[model samples]
Target: MAGKRKTKASKAKQDDLAKPSKWRLQHGAFSGPIRAADPETGTPVQHRRAVDTLGMMLASGSITAQMHEAGEIFRGLFRAACFDSMSTSQLLRIPGSRVDTLSTMQIEARRRVAAALDLLGGHESPCGSCAWFVVGLEFSVREWSMRQGWAGRTVHGPVGQGILVGTLGTLAMHFGLTPRAKAA
Candidate 1:
């Protein structure tokens, strides 16, 4: 052989690098065989079965389309409010202090988020408790569960996720995005 041969593990990794990723895990639930990636690095990984929370829930019939829309809207608002900007404020250029500023829309978005939080009640409220974590931070159910447990909270897997779903429903109602019920 003119050069070093490819080891079985290396060959296997190369083969596994391009697999499609549809499978997901939520609170230890499993699904796909998609291509994986190193969590810390962007390099290709192998044999990853993790999936996104909202997509998996929609596909698995765990959440309704309206709920999904609501969740997405909430996530969108959070993303927008964050991405819209908060550069330094010149209105108060008294010194070298960097005064953060936001546009009217971003302010409105933050207000809306505040209103949404109010609608969800407080940090102690069941639905409200997990809303920010799941919607804003986008934690997976398993991660949320672990975090809650670590925080000295009672963390039932299904119930925790249910609270998140319920919060999305509440958001949908707040946004007027909920679909009216069809008559039987």
Candidate 2:
């Protein structure tokens, strides 16, 4: 009886060992077991250099400056777009037009700047909502310009507002606006 009990206990222990670990059970279906990368092994030279460069840019506040510039460009576009009578040249000539245009520009600029900072800090991904808003705004501006004979006409009054808005929006995303994830 004692020998039988010992054999059963040993068998149970062996069976437990044969099963996959809890971590493996959770993450192994799609990929193999997760293992930490060895730091001593080191990443490839090119990858290491790229990482270093990005780190330096972040540390030196270059990315933040770039992001600010991008936002400023967008804000300029927004100011330029809101004018009901000013020609494109006139709008271009003026710097920091009165803060009386659509409130959307202000909100979007803030969002873009915040998103860029978040991306640089690795706190969040790029913002898709902001990108989409800009895209829609660009389309509307282009259509409005066309209707007003600003673009798609013999005398091109000014650079298309659509182009400016689209460019600014794209720059914002490139600097670090998080994109939305597709549903699985």
Candidate 3:
């Protein structure tokens, strides 16, 4: 009878182990609460699903796909920033409007990327040369992706390059490939 009771207790323990834990069922893998606002802007986050999806793609190693998707995201942001009444014809008629718009976006992207790299804790060059280096690295990646048959295009090629530079640079910094900037 004692041996039988021990077997029964072991079986009960096995059953408990087979059942998924409550936390696992609730959060699956990620456990932290999602942020409601952008850390920089303090505004309610927009395109939450798209941003999360991009993160998932990056984790999954779908680089080229994410690159194309990033272009689409930039285009969406550009459109969102435009006046609601602005039409495609009106936008096209402005002299250098497209170039100006794309340049603005690229500059903004580069700035944001640089800020992100700083947040990742690394020694970056004070002359802002590291950001440009990141831009070149990102541009090379874009060109390579194009060669590999990525079809999407941004209005200004540098827009995607700037974003890529910031991202890859941050990764490099995180891995200690890029040294942290020294205090003056």
lDDT leader:
1
- Residue 47 lDDT in model 1? 68
Clashing pairs in model 3?
122-180, 123-179, 123-180, 123-181, 124-181
Ranking according to TM-score, highest score first? 1, 3, 2
lDDT against the true structure, per candidate, is: 0.70, 0.40, 0.41
Worst 10 residues of 3 by lDDT: 126-135
What stretches of model 1 exceed 4 Å from their correct place?
1-50, 83-99, 149-152, 179-184
Model with the higher TM-score, candidate 1 or 2? 1
Q: TM-scores of the models, in the given order?
A: 0.62, 0.18, 0.20
Candidate 1 residue 96 C-alpha distance from true site, Å: 6.4
Model 2 per-residue lDDT tens digits across residues 78-126: 4444422343334344577753455776567556544543443422222
Query: Residue-wise lDDT of candidate 3 within 1-184, one digit each (tens)?
Result: 4564444445433334434456656633442444478889899753323133234445667444434343334334334434222344454476554633545665565555445445544323311332233232222344433432223532234444444545544444443444556210
Ranking of predictions according to lDDT: 1, 3, 2
Candidate number of the best TM-score: 1
Clashes of each: 3, 5, 5
lDDT: worst 10-residue window of model 1: 19-28
